[model samples]
Target: MAETIDDKIKNYRTAPFDARFPNVNQTRNCYQNYLDFHRCNKALAAKDQDVSPCEWYHRVYKSLCPISWVQKWDEQIENGSFAGKI
Candidate 1:
């Protein structure tokens, strides 16, 4: 059987050490997580499915990105001005 999105969510662990972001620069990871959170929410909402799984990305970005950056993004999202791909 194929793995469902729910199964993936149920099996979620912390984000592993990404080879792409070695050393003290987790910028890519943070940005990716931010994009993923929005994408997950949009996808699940469209399908009327559980959005809980999207929380992983939320947690990751929350831990890795600056609060101000998140706040700015939130504002941009609300105002339809965010530039980054969702």
Candidate 2:
């Protein structure tokens, strides 16, 4: 079955954050951490030319979902966070 945007986001949220960031334990705040990780992953993927997932997430986050709470995870990474390495 084809995965929906919600499925992708939900799956991402279920995964362990540290697994993606081996050097950082960003799971302190579940919701915030997940959203940040999701946005970062999306932006990084886009930067790497892997746009499908990023575009899907962006569409959903901008339309059906609301990602206003989490600050720009992509910007945080670019500003020297561990996210830049990923």
Candidate 3:
């Protein structure tokens, strides 16, 4: 049997150190999670599939990113000004 998204979520762990975010700061990790969450949601929704897998990214970004940054990005996305790929 295949692992379900819920299973993955239940087994979620902190992300390991990534080359892209080698410094002490986790800014890149936060931003990447933000982008990943949106992309995951969009792709899953387009396929009419379960989106539970995307929750991992949401949790990461929510924990690592400032609320203001998230709010600003959301506004940018709404206004078509966000620079990152969705």
Candidate 4:
């Protein structure tokens, strides 16, 4: 049998293992997920598509990144100063 996106989402609990970030240090992974969430959301919204899929990135980052960092990055994004490309 095959799995669906809904199944994947429902099964998700926390950030999963990413081969790209093999080391114990997850700072890069956290930041990348944060950026991915916004970028995914933005792209879908721009296309008038459902943004639910972006929740995956949101959940991953929320589980990995610190609240303070998220807040600071959000502020920087709002002020057009965030260093990330998103």
Instruction: Give Cα-based local distance difference scores for all models.
Output: 0.86, 0.49, 0.90, 0.95
Error of 3 at 14 (Å): 6.4
Clashing pairs in 3: none
Candidate 4 positional error at 36, Å = 0.8
How well does candidate 3 score on lDDT at residue 1?
72
- Where model 3 places Cα greater than 4 Å from the true spot, the runs are 1-20
The C-alpha RMSD of each candidate to the native structure, in angstroms, is 3.8, 8.2, 3.0, 1.0
Question: Against the true structure, what is each candidate's TM-score?
Answer: 0.77, 0.28, 0.80, 0.93
Best by lDDT: 4
Please report the candidate that would top TM-score against the real structure. Answer: 4
Question: Which tens-of-lDDT digit does each residue in 47-70 have in candidate 1?
Answer: 999999888788778878999999
Per-residue lDDT for 51-79 in model 3, tens only? 98899889878878999999999999999
Per-residue alpha-carbon lDDT of candidate 2 for residues 1-86, written as tens digits (9 for 90 to 100): 99987687656533333354455433334344445446667687768865455444343334322355335554574576634334
The runs of at least 3 residues in candidate 2 whose Cα sits more than 4 Å from the true structure, single-residue gaps closed, are 1-53, 64-72, 82-86
Cα-lDDT of candidate 2: 0.49
Model 4: which ten-residue window has the lowest total lDDT?
1-10
**Model 4 off-target regions past 4 Å?**
none
lDDT of candidate 4 over 1-86, digit per residue (tens): 79998899899898899999999999999999999999999999999999999999998999999999999999999999999997
Worst 10 residues of 2 by lDDT: 57-66
TM-score of 1: 0.77
TM-score, model 3 to reference: 0.80
